[model samples]
Target: QISEATDAPEAFVAKILQPLSKKGILISNKGKQGGFTVDLDKIEHIKIIEIILATDGEEIFTRCAFGLEKCSSEKPCPFHFTYKPIREGLKSSLSEISIYDMALKTEQGEAFLKI
Candidate 1:
């Protein structure tokens, strides 16, 4: 249902399912008729950060935009001030939202993972 709803290939969706299963975001079953399922409790608690970490890694949050040798507050990049707040907002949003919230929207037809 998730793959279909997202309009993604089953293989691609299966790959994504790997990290979620590893991080305990979801549990999957096997065999002729088995599939993935989530513990509602875990779904509600698993933040987007956990998903991103399980799949995409956290380098995005830690890296300097310009890739400068020294790009900290003491010797900031040109975009540091401008990018900092946006980054912080992204971080906050990722941490604040849980899979349950997204699932709810999808379930209600308020949003779709794919057009």
Candidate 2:
């Protein structure tokens, strides 16, 4: 259902689900009634940062926006300083946003999962 709704291949969704499940962000069942679900009790404590890190890893927070091999403060790339603050800001925002907040936004039509 998620794959179809997102227009992503089942394999792609499966790959994403594996990491999330391993990280305890998702609960997966493997039977006729099998499906993945989030623990509603814990959902309010699950920040966007946790979901992103579980699925995408730390590279998104560490890698260069311009794809420079060794971009860093010591030997900065062209956009290093400029991108640093933006990345940090995004990280901070994600850390503060819970899945519940996003769900509320989606439910209230203030945000969306697609488009």
Q: Please state every model's RMSD to the true fold in angstroms.
A: 1.9, 1.5
Question: How accurate locally is residue 96 in candidate 1, as Cα lDDT from 0 to 100?
Answer: 96
Residue lDDT tens for model 2, 1-115: 8898678888888888888889899999999988789999999999999989998888888899889888899999989999999999999999999999998998899987677
TM-score of 1: 0.84
Residue-level lDDT tens digits of model 1 in 7-62:
88889988998888877787988999877888876778889888888888976776
Native-to-model Cα distance after best TM-score fit, residue 95 in candidate 1, in Å:
1.1
Runs with alpha carbons beyond 4 Å of true place in candidate 2? none
lDDT of each: 0.83, 0.90
Superposed by TM-score, candidate 2 places the C-alpha of residue 52 at a distance from the truth, in angstroms, of: 1.0
Highest TM-score model number: 2
